[model samples]
Target: MDKRESKIPLIRFPEFKEGWEHKQLNELLKVSKKKNKDLKYSKEEVLSVSGELGIVNQIEHLGRSYAGASVHNYGLVENGDIVYTKSPLKENPYGIIKLNKGVPGIVSTLYAVYKVKDNNADGEFIEHYFSLDANTNRYLRPLVRKGAKNDMKINNEYVLHDRIFVPKKEEQKRIAHFFNVIDTKINQLKEKQNLLEEYKKGVMQKIFTQKIRFKKEDGSDFENWDNTTLGKVFKIFNGYAFSSKDSCENGVKWVKIADVGIQRMQRENVSFLPFEFRELHKKFLLKKGDFVIALTRPILNGELKIAEIDDFFHNSLLNQRVGKIISSNNLIFIYYFLQQQWLINSIEKNIAGTDPPNLSAKEIDHIKVSIPKVKEQEKIAKILSNIDNKIAKSINQIDNLKNYKKALLQQMFCY
Candidate 1:
């Protein structure tokens, strides 16, 4: 490590030129051990601290507050209180440090709550630095000891004894303020993306249910729809079964049921077929705009993963238990229709009751669907696609913003 006296960050605000000094956590905050004596106290103020999200309302985290009525000896916490959970969370098998603000609440004894004692230290700034540093858990890991439960954890003593580097109050304010602004924009982008997705869902419902109708060349409403089986409209081709022995480092990339998502193939967990076998299964090769579905465990995620293939999707080989939906009619319409909520629920319930966990291609093809005129189908698909494109663009922007914030975090803090 560089000399503590010369502890400069990779990037600085230029206004302040002094090197940052390292300080143990005990110098800044100490564990707050105040407890609730009144079991029936209305100051239940239950809250939870998530690894990434920090402090949040308990109801929001657990659907309902786990601390119902009569929560005794619960730790009392106020706004600006810092909570350190020494146990492992879901994705974070280590621990998380957080600052609770505005959402004044109570947490369980399981959490070691601390309060800032030093006037110069900023709780939010400290929390942000620890969060940005990936080794935060490791730094605190030594504090952890085996508890009655299987999980190991640090106690209040260790939590209060730890230390970290903190800048002067003004500098801390500048850094915290910068991240806050970026966070606000990120939240706004996410909200816009979510609203657009919800709007598209409503639009899909309207079009599929005939609440909204498309017109003909003369501007007249299209004729009544015809009820037909999916098999009648489209040819469902199940993917080829390539053995594990045929799997290779490089060759045709094969998509499995696990790779399929309603929006698109994730393509991350995809396996590849041996180059030798690629020549024999040319017809099995998939191309752009090919609509596909997961056949086995079709309803595993509550809804099926239906997606249109990307033109440049690598190799694009289809594996068994996955299938491509083919139609001479408008392909986009079929893709959207399959995603209709009520239709999917009905299919899932049917499959859940009698069918094995696995659904066969024949069962899927037998499902009934409403077929509108080709022109009307084309119009509906176009409208939905436009909304989907907007949502996709917003998501891409949010991702870029998150990446930029990550880069800033890496540069703005010292080791």
Candidate 2:
């Protein structure tokens, strides 16, 4: 209990002054060898471990059971049991471990399940301890042996041999509870964001279908929406075919096909072109408030790969296979209409049977859409924009909470 001689977390509760004790995971947990031998759990109870979502119902998380033909050989996971998947993830290359807080489920043989040996250690605390990617990778990388196929070669029992620092049972509970509260807040914000998105989707459907309409400032009804092809109302200009040699480390930002996301631009791994190229590629330059869409693999999950240019990407040169939308009419209105499911379906139908699905300027220009008057368009855009602002705020709050939790994990645990 000597503060100077023992290991301690960077952050600790005032009531707990003692340093954390170093103990092997084997001393705290035992491998669960229980199998679903007697058909106790059905294939419907199959579970999967996600680095972000922890242990979740396989069918619910992935939309279908990736289970093998037989369920009899699956591993049984009881409530509070720890499960480790040998499958590598982008964040956790060695695999991931999670504690099952939901109903008892069965996982594939690829997973190794465990149970706490006694009340001396907390399973949730252990899960959180390994929550940080670096901490988990540091602990598992050395112990794991890779097979010829790059699969993890360690067995269930050997996985628990590593040692880790742990607090007393009381401190463990406190830390776990504190993280649980943060997790709850994050989940609530996520739920709110989801609901707001769903609400916007429903409202958009009603407004576009004319099930609902916006009245004029004088309380009079606006005219019916006009049906017209995209080509008639807007010009679809394809980006210039910039070569890889044009790419540079520092210069004008280049907007490639990969930069376009659903309603936003992805700034990660961004490429740049020489600043002077901005003048050479004047037609390819995207300005603030410009609407752009990916022409290569344009549709994903029933949504168009479209984004509105922001200040950060203003005057950025656009690369090939991405289209810039220009219209004299309400540009924001057109942007919102392009997001409609029906438009996406039409685009898909046009590109059906095509490999590496692409959307040509001609194809996009040919799609028909219903549009209201400019005033009504402005009203609709304002309404949708307000909802989007709320959704964005929720996303920002959730990300902040996750970052906060990540920071807490770094300090609260003895790495």
Candidate 3:
């Protein structure tokens, strides 16, 4: 093969022996001029181009339509049409290209839609090819001129003038199908995770509300749950105020507010303190099985920013604005009970008008809770923990699959 035509991906199917062809995108695509000029598609049919979800219904994705008063001037996007969103994103500053694989819809004028020009190329292949951030950035960086407002300044037709390498039609189809299978697997895992979460939520509601109750080993009924304020059960205290300047490279892990996720600890961007600080901040130290909650902005997306310290975060120093809960009662039972929606509602009611939504030790202590006998608490906690373990496993599997797909994208496409 000629040197100019020798461009090929690092990984290719055994059946494909030839190098990929180098050509301008315009050779395979053309700007879509179709519009909703006749008012055939309403604002209800408006679509939004998402980097992760591709082209999706604007209302369904965002929970509301952001379309302007007029819809007749919107671009009409048909199935398999390529849409470019000119809006800048953190990952794709030059914008992103996505294929509309769903029903025909109308997109706002900010989006540029295009159609496949001929049988020489596949739309799905183009979509997958640009799916990699490096691929999209490299192709668009030089061509996308930024306006004063940081918006994309390139014309829709000009975007297709960039050169790209493409395999034969058959190879293109195979590659697209391969990635599609991976995507399907990811989606299936996500669905399973969602169902498990829903099941857990429902079961937790029933258990906490006393709609369902556990019994003794003999299957006889246990005593009714007793109501008590959180203060009567657990001693909640905020962590020590650690100075950022004192942070060290290696030593005790620092559990900052950002590290506390909903029912999980986020280890990304972790910071550490000097080993000597552990003795100085013994009161703020967190051990394994410790329960902690964010005092500032305690709730996110309707979920509490609370989690139990696991092995990975054991012996860590908790930073200020994070409350540590210590209890003589079954801590696991209390942790699960706090996750109940009704309990969260009670917390929200206390902090209703507070700006930035924070919680004080006094206010948290005043919150009421219901508890059963120690044996019943142990049984209930065991059941809920089992469900949580399954959810965590599903999440880990999804993350692994996503990482695998990311690796495949890097090797399967020529940069």
Backbone Cα, N, C clashes tallied per candidate? 4, 0, 0
**Candidate 2, residue 32: CA error in Å?**
0.3
Q: Candidate 1, after superposition: displacement of residue 334 in Å?
A: 1.8
Q: Against the correct fold, how does model 2 do in TM-score?
A: 0.96
**Once superposed on the true structure, which residue ranges of model 3 sit more than 4 Å away at CA?**
1-4
Candidate 1: clashing pairs of residues: 24-163, 25-162, 25-163, 45-106
lDDT of 3 by residue, 1-415 (tens): 1125657788888998888878788888999999999999998999998888899999999999898999999999999899999998989999999999999999987899999865878899899988988888988998999999998898998898778888888898999999999999999989999999999999988888789988899989999877888788777678888999999899999898899999999888899999999998888889999999998899988889999999999999989989898787888988887887877888888887888888886776877777898999999999999999999999999999989988998888775
- Which scores higher on TM-score, 1 or 3? 3
The residue ranges of model 2 lying beyond 4 angstroms of the native Cα positions read: 1-5
Give lDDT per model, in order: 0.77, 0.88, 0.88
> Which residue pairs clash within candidate 2?
none
lDDT (Cα, tens digit) per residue for candidate 2, span 1-415? 1122358888899999888877778878999889999999887899999988888899999999988888999999999999989988888889988899988989998999999865788888989988889988888998898888879999998898888888899999999999999999999999999999999999999988989999999999999888888778778788888988878889999889889999999988789899899898787889999999898899888899999999989999988889898787888988888888887898888887778898876766777777888999999899999999999999999999999999999999985
Tally clashes: model 3.
Answer: 0
Q: List the residue pairs that clash in candidate 3.
A: none
| Runs in model 1 lying further than 4 Å from the true structure | 1-6, 40-45, 65-70, 89-91, 133-135, 145-150, 354-356
